[model samples]
Target: MVVDELNEGRIGLEEMKVGGIFPNLKVFKNKVKEYAIERKFVFVPVDSKPTKYAVRCKDKSCPFRISGRISLDHVMVKRFVPEHTCSGTMRGNDHPLVTAAWAADTCLGLFPCPGDVRPTLIRAYIKDKWGITISYVKAFNAKIIIHEKMCGNAEASYRILPAYAEEMERCNPGTIMCVYRSRELWTGGDSTFCRLFWSFGPSIRAFSQTIRPLILINGTHLRGKYKGILLAATAVDGDGGLFPLAYAVVENEMYESWL
Candidate 1:
């Protein structure tokens, strides 16, 4: 049961700090794992207790075992057998670059435009910070994964469009919002996204008063899992500023979509 609990990867009560002053068992264990991973080593737990914990390198021939004791106010290192007879290079989730959560947090503040995030930039950033190199494929996948983490999935977002539109109309009266769905011929039943159009009340009022008679229209392809196009209309204000009138997401930039 103890081994199973340890393998479950959850921090137990024994691993938690009693007060602000005392050190946590999980904190000590994480620090040990962090140290080993940073130095490119793999370890397995040999023994675990409330007051003491011990871990040895996975390599059978290696005599490395890091053992420490939990004290009243601090964690104390009891013994350190720092010798590994392993021959293989470093691999696995222990590496910082390979973990999705870590990668997401690392790139969260850096990439404002998810589409512009490149593998080369991610690799360069990781190398500069941690002095570790990751493969281009890994970096690319990390970019996508991090973006998904930051923004909800495209399909899921589409599902909630109706609720969002309803909320907008409720919050601001005179808001014009429409969602169109079409059934696939081959599927015979399931409905797919056709088009979505929305114009906020404030924007409609503002455009009517301060915007020019001529409206500029444009469409851009959405580079997401669900391929689509975003169409927008804007008018110039009296002060030469761009005033947004309305926008729509459609299957394509067709005459029907514009209408």
Candidate 2:
């Protein structure tokens, strides 16, 4: 019932704010805890398993790497593992397994496109939130931003995207894959495709049997509706996938074209 009476109640928590003891705690929200404290450290505990929401370093050299990000489809909730070894400094940044993985990117890309390439939430967290230098290539575990329009019952667009994705894997086996959408995929002046593939190509192979062994295609239509298509094709790879793959459709009736 009173401030001095709190200790008599035998509560274990110490360092109650001044206002918290009183009726109105809003005035004490800004008060500091008198206990020992330090800044947010830059280390993940050894043996600590991180949540899907945790960030990975954008540096391929960083030791604290993360697994897949949380998504509407792959709604994973797993324990964390230390990105670095339990003890000792890391060997180097490029040591593959022991080293970290990054999302190598030369340009800023929006996401849910399926391409391993993308601008990450880590980039936003670093640049916008933390003001840190986030590397596009090194943030292997960062979540790429997705267009709300691009996500849907197709399970956030990742479900139906596998068709072209199969081709991307077939053609560019080692490369990270992606999917995007556009309302219009025109074909002319090297600018036939809609904005989805506006920046994409004149591939090595045209739409023929032997020439069109592999493909990747999707669209990120501005309307955010279910009305776009994309495609990419390539030679079969050792994995029975394709090679020299492009990523989307640049023409009309693309889904039908795939048929």
Candidate 3:
């Protein structure tokens, strides 16, 4: 029955032999890792070499493992022990559903409207989709990981602000872009990023031509690694739709920052 299920693709099998001309050990290890994930088991690297690699189950109690060595022409499988002595319960951390890629896919459409992408919502979504309940911390971490994947790390993004602003100005003429930085008095090193303000040319044009004179200003506190405030100015269009005019990221939501 197990062999039939493996043959029919109902269950993934731990193959005793893998024949391929892999470019490197990293590629071979990744291929084995994918196979383990498909079989609902976590792959933990035991050791590796220039032409050989070994991997085992993430569970210390589980005795499943495989070791292979690279040959001149192809990768040679020296040993394949496919039997797992585990208790048959999947660990939350090792499960395929609790991954960064899974989180990115789960929160794909909710990137723009961040307010709707709460941990509770993500937990419910996972439960609905996979019938598995994940903890709040896992869900929250997923949210952060997805944001990092989409927009890059918050601190690192600051480092590229100057180039980003310059590129925007070059691509869209008349775009208002500014990046401010301050040198630390004690360190005397490179300038540290302080604030960034930008307004696209098309948004400025639309605000001047079609948007109402009435403008609404709002600010939100960022909850990422670097703490700051995102201040935005918006106006209503002729069709009574909210039109974003400009935005700025500042260290604090003070009167000077608002100005």
Candidate 4:
């Protein structure tokens, strides 16, 4: 589990000093990256191990460096030289520390709502926040990176449908969720996702009680890593708003799939 100190505003890179402690090596590395990116500098890890970490400014002549070692499950900075002799203007357009994952995390921190953010917004946010201009491709890749992190890989999501359906039924009685597999894993020695149909108890009850009798059904194409189709059953509410009823995910929108 990540330590609470890793949360935003709990700690800042400028606060790092000699003998400072970090929850783990990953946090330490990330802090260093944030420090370098924010200052428009570049650092190269001289040594990175399970228990120890060391980095120096990319310019060999620069004195900016940090070294840490693990102690009691936390990394303690043993040495820190916060002095830079090289001109910090070496960075052009983008810094080496500004990776796709870093860009994604920064965008998520600045813009908490994922659905409301776009690649152009991500590019602008990075430029405004870090003074680093990344390519459109990089911003788009950052979007993809965070999307996979928030919503797991498509293939893995399909594999967890059975358990998800079970949990849904347990949490909300009268919920209808079905998962169809191409084959039984134990008996057939393999299994693959074929289709899924789910209708939450709340949505079902709400539609039955307040929605219009007329229902509109539609299917949309999934353009993610895994290709499939999403079928949704929606009803018009008294306010003329669409009320979600049931949904299905299938390989294709065919007669059997609708049934």
Candidate 5:
């Protein structure tokens, strides 16, 4: 404990609570994640690189910085994973911890919104929870396509997010939020996931109707500590089925950040 680090409360490295001690670090992590989201707290992922300099340079216009990096590659979902999931082995599909799948489970909330069944309400709910709204810098869309979108036989490339402190600090130059870029569209195997899930409820029904409702979602890490953006679409019909139509990873949302 930091108390142990200090001599009888005397000044030591610095007085602080021990962030982790028990093997169940996840206990504290869950508390922090929920608190952060509910409080609209933006978390900056720690940079992995050792800082040759004290604090990172605060140049807003630095290309490596958020203010300068107009096209943030860090927006991909892959960047959110941690060290434990992959014994540090495997590539592309090799994260021993923090997969994009895990991120979604966390951000969906401990409970559904009392009245946020509407896409607009869902949008409002997410905005209130994470302090972000629809914008192009973090533009992700959900459009109902006539056909399914499967990349199994298609050419593709995905992002690999940085997991270091220096890179993270630079990525979030303003030092307010973090970006974990990704392309995790949840289109079902059916001809249309949108139509398949109609009539689930008022929320799902209304959500299913929007052919192109801009959806912003985030996946929770397996350890359930981190969260990131997930943009998806749904279909609306007489019965109201809300199926995932399509989606992409995204980032920064200024008042002018509409998709």
Candidate 6:
């Protein structure tokens, strides 16, 4: 699911009551971390377990602390001390709790297209929106994390090609799907993916009967971490609209690949 906003009516550190209930431990932890980031404070975990979680202000002298425990499949806050006695000097641009995974999830909505997400843009966005300063490496890592979350990793995607082709053929009986692998499979138990081609049954029939005779074949470079070319075939319908007929992904635009 796509998350559009943060803190969206969810309870924060200040708003949390002693008996407040959170859906799960992850939600409770995320809320606390987000609160810490927003308030420019630091929290150190005092007690962390499967059924219980506890944290106090980074400053040992501070009296602010909170703890929650799992109760009947939900985490219930058992202790709450929202006030802090120490001066907020431990907070700064860098936060130890802000991880790449957390940043990726927090700003997922900003990355509609993974290709356009640059590290510099991510850094600027986080700084401007959340008042948090993250290093370039963290921003770059966050981009990678978001890319994998949006589109599966390259290795996993390659491994599932055969299953995807089988499922496609099963769903559309007349669909044509093919996966080619390189001959080098001795070292790694999995075969190296070379190319993939697919065409839907409905699209083939529509192109043959209703679409225009003119076929436009074009090839574009894939923008993911893997370097490849995306070859596509489309036909102009009666309304001057392009209708997709087939697609192929190959290591390069070669005669054999097109064939």
TM-score of each: 0.65, 0.21, 0.62, 0.75, 0.20, 0.74
Q: What does candidate 1's lDDT look like per residue over 16-66, in tens digits?
A: 222212255655665565456456776778888877778888776888777
Residues 158-216, model 5: lDDT tens digits: 22123332354465443322233223444543221111011123334445464446454
Worst 10 residues of 6 by lDDT: 1-10
lDDT of 4 by residue, 1-259 (tens): 2344447446777778887878877777788888888878888889877778899998899999899997667888889998888877344788777888888877776655557657898889988877889988888989887777776667788778899999999999889999998877577669888899999998889888988998999999987677899999999999999999999999999999999
Worst 10 residues of 1 by lDDT: 13-22
Worst window of 10 by summed lDDT in candidate 4: 1-10
Off by over 4 Å in 6: 1-9, 89-92, 109-125, 150-154, 170-174, 183-188, 200-218, 233-246
> lDDT tens string, model 2, 24-122?
221111111101111111333232223233333334355543232333332232322334433333232222211112222212243436443344654
lDDT of 5 at 227: 28
Which residue runs of candidate 4 sit more than 4 Å off their true CA positions?
1-4, 7-10, 89-91, 148-153, 167-175, 184-189, 199-216, 233-246
The per-prediction tally of clashing pairs is 0, 37, 0, 0, 41, 0
* Local distance difference test values of all predictions, in order: 0.71, 0.34, 0.71, 0.83, 0.28, 0.83
Off by over 4 Å in 5: 1-18, 21-107, 110-118, 136-259
Clashes of 4: 0
State model 5's lDDT: 0.28
lDDT of 6 by residue, 1-259 (tens): 1111244344544656788777777777887888777777889999998778999999999898999987656788899888878767345687777889888877777877877878888889888877889999998899999888888788898898899999999988789999999875677665788899999998999988999999899999887678999999999999999999999999889899999
Per-candidate Cα RMSD to the true structure, in Å, reads 7.6, 20.2, 6.7, 4.5, 23.1, 4.8
Off by over 4 Å in 2: 1-40, 44-125, 138-259
Query: Model 4 Cα displacement at 77 (Å)?
Result: 2.4
In angstroms, give how far residue 193 of model 3 lies from its true place.
2.2
The global Cα lDDT (0 to 1) of model 3 is 0.71
Global CA lDDT of candidate 4, please?
A: 0.83
Candidate 2 yields a Cα-based lDDT of 0.34
